[model samples]
Target: MSAFSDVELLHDFLTEAGDLLEDVDSKLVELEQSPEDAELLATVFRGFHTIKGGAGFLEATHLVELCHKTENLFDKLRSKKLLLDAEMMDSIMAATGEVHRMFGEMRNGHQPGAAPVELLDALDAAIEGRTVAAAAVVEQVAIQTASEQAHSPVVAEDDLDWAGLYEAVVGVAPRELEQAALSTGMATEAISRQAAAAVRPKAPASKAKAAGPATTTAKENSIRVDTVRFDQILNLSGEIGLTKNRLSCLFQSINAGVVNDDLIKSLDTVVGQLDMLVSDLQSAVMKARMQPVGRVFQKYSRLARDVSRQLGKDVELVIEGAETEVDKSILEELNDPLIHLVRNAVDHGIETIEDRIACGKNPKGIVNLSARQTGDHIVIEIQDDGRGMRPEIIREKAVEKGLISSEEAGQLSVQESLQLIFLPGFSTKDQISDISGRGVGMDVVKTNIQRLNGRIEIQSEPGHGSKITILLPLTLAILPVLMLKLEEQIYSLPLSSVREIIPIEEDRVQFVSGKPTMVVRGEVIPLLDLATLIGRESNPGPKVGVLAVSGDRACILAVDSLVGQDEVMIKPLEGIKPKGVAGATLSGEGLLVLVLELRELIEGKL
Candidate 1:
């Protein structure tokens, strides 16, 4: 009767229907590849059937009607009564997209209406193997809706008195009025049952009959908790870890002054146990936030197929390591970046069938997506076995866009030239289209990845293929930092950005192009002193250098000394961020260690 009472029902429907839509979407893409897969057809049919039933209960009028028609089409295809063709599949996919939109509206507290007349007409025609040659409908209209529950009973035929039934449904009427609905045709079963129940007299049941056992299964034991609650738990665990650190400090200090051997031994033992328990609790909380990356990866399968078809190319996307677990927040942020990369491969990286054939390669191009866990970081790679990028073309485009001069472009190495794509408004294409070529997406992709404290590297040959690698930290809440010491002040940098450490010798260092450089593995790496970057006056020495690798550049950071590494729980600053600090961490000795964002620091230096 009221929207307030339907909150739980709507939430349940959304949760179940959200999963069903994903299943149907992924299966619809597979069905396109193998149209004759009987099992896929049946599974997709059942997916829509179950969603429709739930929608009916919630009175999601548009969703129910849309799923109803799609279910019919799939049933026909499953039974071999109708054929699955390109046009038919397109119609079904379009309806699925509409259902997704309606769900969004419903989530925002807006009641969704019916599917468009054009779409409904197209689905109706599709079930009968007919085609609607009209363009896909862009606008939607609302149709009157009724909930399966809270609706008047339906008469099957014209055998009942219509006026009496209408009065009974919408107004208070006498018991005799309901009796008039009982005499009707077979189509009037619903109204007849309602009439009989309304006018019947109840009799008391026997004690033996009343003792019949109820039949019902207990629901599975579980409750859904918000992710924010888990985050609070993680924060508490970090506080506990800090307390353990303090206890450890106290335990060691008390032993030296006080000559209580038994007291020292008990404190040491209790501190050790608390340390272990705190570590375990922190790890458990981290795992609670971990979600399989496959949830985000699944949506890309359909994207690759659709974009490849639109480009008039034959490309197949092969996904690996779908079970790799990453932070749930990371997965959400990764969705759009991965999409841009996948589309770029389909549109710009992959060659058409004829072009691929001319190159003596297979007609279908292959796009590979793989993920792996390396220590405390997640690595995801997107590779395409098609014509790779040309450094020369990128150089010329850079020159044309005024991003670099002719002399500067000529001086760039092949690897350096490829890095120009990350510059805003850099594109080699002569025309613009819906997908790309307007110099928009690549720079944003790099920016978003970097915002996640991730680095992206591109490796491509002239004609072989191209691979894009994305390296991200395990969780955003905690960072594994390589602590570096500069006299009395300590600094922290993400270990993910630290490629290696090298000893900087004055004799071995030389100036190549008005910049200090050092040779490492035959590659010239830029060298920087930490004191010079931060305007700190210190005596230089032959100290160890941190080879900070961000994006495609490697810079050797000279520091006073190397401090041992540790996992630091970072506390984010609210406002007015410092010059080079991303956040600050408190060490066991009550010292504040400033965490450096290596990418930002390096960029500011250059």
Candidate 2:
């Protein structure tokens, strides 16, 4: 049997190899800085060596070849034989990337193919460059070709002549196979194979079932399941939530006192116990899916280093609160957004080395990325102590992009001006660099955060520095929400964003620039009727207001009444999800209530 047919072994190899690749990639970046760190060099070498062994066992020959070359190079570096250089580090990083790609290919059930000879040759050249500075070879064997070959020979994604070809290949004589099909020139005629297949009796469905997806039926099956059983817990928890709908119907039927007090007490006790059990299960499952954000943060360390080097600037990435844990799903979705933010920090937020020195700032620019659990949300801040954003330049760019009129742009508050950065098609750089100048990233970051029920806040000063704060929910699947009523229609607001529920006073209301404004604790905040925001008729009677804040901005949402608070399982809508509505959940009353996307609702109005 093929090594990959041993599903258990293959999964083990994939998991271990993936981790090794990440570790080696990070160590390679560190080794670039301290070329002589023998300890780090040894760690990286072993990481590659172990992966090579596993790949070899899996018959992933191409991956083995690439890792073997990297391991050998690291071995030489560790022994003080071949010294590490920028060019050499680049080659190693590229080789590691190829190894990662190979793992992905294997994961998708594709046979691993050879790396481009150019890449293998580049690895050889980088190792050789210690003595000869193999510039010619490195140029000849470019990583560009490797990337091209990685996904080369794009063919029609359809099966062609599978049955006939399978029979032709299998029908070859044993003697001919001994001589090799190539030497024997055993090319089967297409017409003859088709005729033979036509003449052959059709196999029953049982035989076809036995054939399945692979060439052989001897392969055993195994699966890689999450240790936390998050899916299982979530599925069962969703079923438990249906009890709300049932109870709502039951209460409606029992409104006439047909149900006795004893029965009510019994139902209440059972439900209360079930709720506690479900909550415990949820916590346990969430804990299982909870991985330290450091796993994602660690990747950016190498990314920031590489980006800063490419930009020819001296910058250090400081990571904090990496041990803070979040849902695995959140971590995966957060990766791209974080990458864009970090790259911008390296390319745009930081000043050039010479400029920093001239300004009497430290030659080394600092981009600090940090995450911490604040209440129900995880706050991630990417702050840089480099060139800060100037509101004047932002206003000019906003006007140029037709995002705002010149006069309107001029009137924008500092906070509002900083927000222009998150508008699509707004970029400050005069010249577009390969890294960031397309002006497409920040807006996407904001959109993604909001998709995850999160918020992004940008703060910058003319000369001090710039800070982008992202506030994200602990998880996207479930949330604790305060269910509210707007004229008999139910709605839910994220409990974390709700600061306080207060009564709306007729006299305290005033006009601020023609918008409704109210004072709370001597601070005036813009107020909007929640009903009007969601396209319902405004309620004129005395109303309750929910004070909600997104980052530094605060607003009051006027609602008809507060129904109470509950934990909700928010199911995403299918198509054309309406604005200001993230998803829907069931109120205990058996009615589907829209979960208010606080960011969209407040931002659109205020």
Candidate 3:
């Protein structure tokens, strides 16, 4: 039953149980709206029952105990022995969260400690039809924590303060620990840092050497591919094999000195056929790696519900286009960014029920989360019907925060002022809380989206609401780029960044602030020499200007000539990372071309 000794068994259990827990979480949120749905009660009961069975099999005593209590409570509800209430739902959710934490512990090859006594007692009381006020418990625990901390003597470095050391290592202070205890009902036991290390399951030498960080969860390394998609890949492989055999026969005939117009034509036709097969195969493989966005979107309903409850707001998250599919890698990286956006919509974008009613709006605010595919890209939007942003307020806040000057703020257009919220350390809230006020979330959302080769745009109207749109590539394996020549060498820029290609006519170009500039429409755009930016000698008489947007800045990249556009599979250069060089790719003629990281190159230039 040791974790290290049964890695494969534990992995299988984790994969199945993790998905079940997520389903249970979403269902619990739904149950809150339809408290009398007997079928939902039954489904949730079975989910916990199944998890408990698996935990029992794996000898996960803590998990089994926790699930056992939660399952029994659901059983009573389904049998009409007890009615579902807000307090009961809160306790159920807290239990589910504790189960998830236990799963994480198991993922790290540790048998989770006992469930908190307070939470277990709360569940037991609910089963007997007694209401437990979760907030009251949290407040009482907080006071006790403060008192304990106030009375404790200060310790020197050599004094070895076990409680303080545990708090630092686990990122949980005494107040949080007490709160966790009440929420989880974990038995009171001092599990210290050294005690945690002592529980690490011993492993064979080879496994010890090959083991990755304990934090590496099984979900990160696994993907679920539909059988139909896998079959498509297999069929494509067979077609490719047949085409390769035909090409081999054609090559032999040519080698036998039978070169003729007919033979050459046959070779050309086969090569073209082979090209088509390879493309189809590549597409099939990429399809195998695609997953529905609902996999990530399903959990957000629960998230929105939790945030609204904590804030004492009546907010509902409406999801759309959940069936749209995107690359699995993008889905994983997207979760955190989307969480920030959703929380922001509820915490900042949505207004309090009382305020909403006062403004002659619906008492309950609505946050819409949606996703869909457009061409080769995926678009995700988080929209909220709450108090819309005021550009002047945003501008004043930016000025106050020293993110922008008064002069600069005064000149910013309405849309530009709204963009200031994405600036680091810029927030409209006067007070900081566990949510929203620190102003780090939106900045992180922008950075993470950009890292995925994506762009985010914010739009808000006074008295209306705010909508944040995210545009991302369908896949990161192939990058659509704008190819250009720098004398003899060629380079590529992400096509998403390139707005247009214009001729660099001498009459149209002018000098502004001693730097080459051009007027595009009404905006003055700075011109940057591509060769100079990449530390290469500039080619004389560069005639092409690429109108590109890197991050939020627009500039013209001067190049020798435009070579059209292409989609290239990027290949990383091992043991070498040149600044501004994203990756390397091969052109049609087998020439190596560097894919430019435009944002990095133009970061400070504009």
Quantify all predictions' global Cα lDDT against the true fold.
Answer: 0.73, 0.72, 0.78
**Each prediction's RMSD to truth:** 22.7, 16.7, 14.1
TM-score-best of 1 and 3: 3
Misplaced by over 4 Å in model 2 are 5-12, 129-279, 461-464, 486-489, 497-562, 573-580, 589-591, 598-606
Number of clashing residue pairs, candidate 1: 2
lDDT of model 1 at residue 504?
85
Per-residue accuracy of model 2 over 1-606 as CA lDDT, tens digit each: 888888778778877777777778677767877999989999998998898888888888888888898888888889998888777876776677677668768877776788767668878876775343333333322123222222111111111232332234335432333333222332223323432353233444554454343233122133234755766677667767776666676677578667878668857865886687677777767677677888778777777776777678988888999999887778767876887888889888899999998999998899999999998789999999988999888889989988889889868987888888888899998778767678887877877776676888888876668999998888877888999987665679888788998888989899989999999999999988987775556878889989998655799999889889988877653212334656655566444466777776666467
Alpha-carbon TM-score of each model against the true structure = 0.71, 0.70, 0.83
Instruction: Evaluate residue 484 in candidate 2 and report its C-alpha lDDT on the 0 to 100 scale.
Output: 90
On the 0 to 100 scale, the lDDT of residue 53 in model 2 is: 86
Model 2 clash pairs are none
Q: Is candidate 1 or candidate 3 better by lDDT?
A: 3
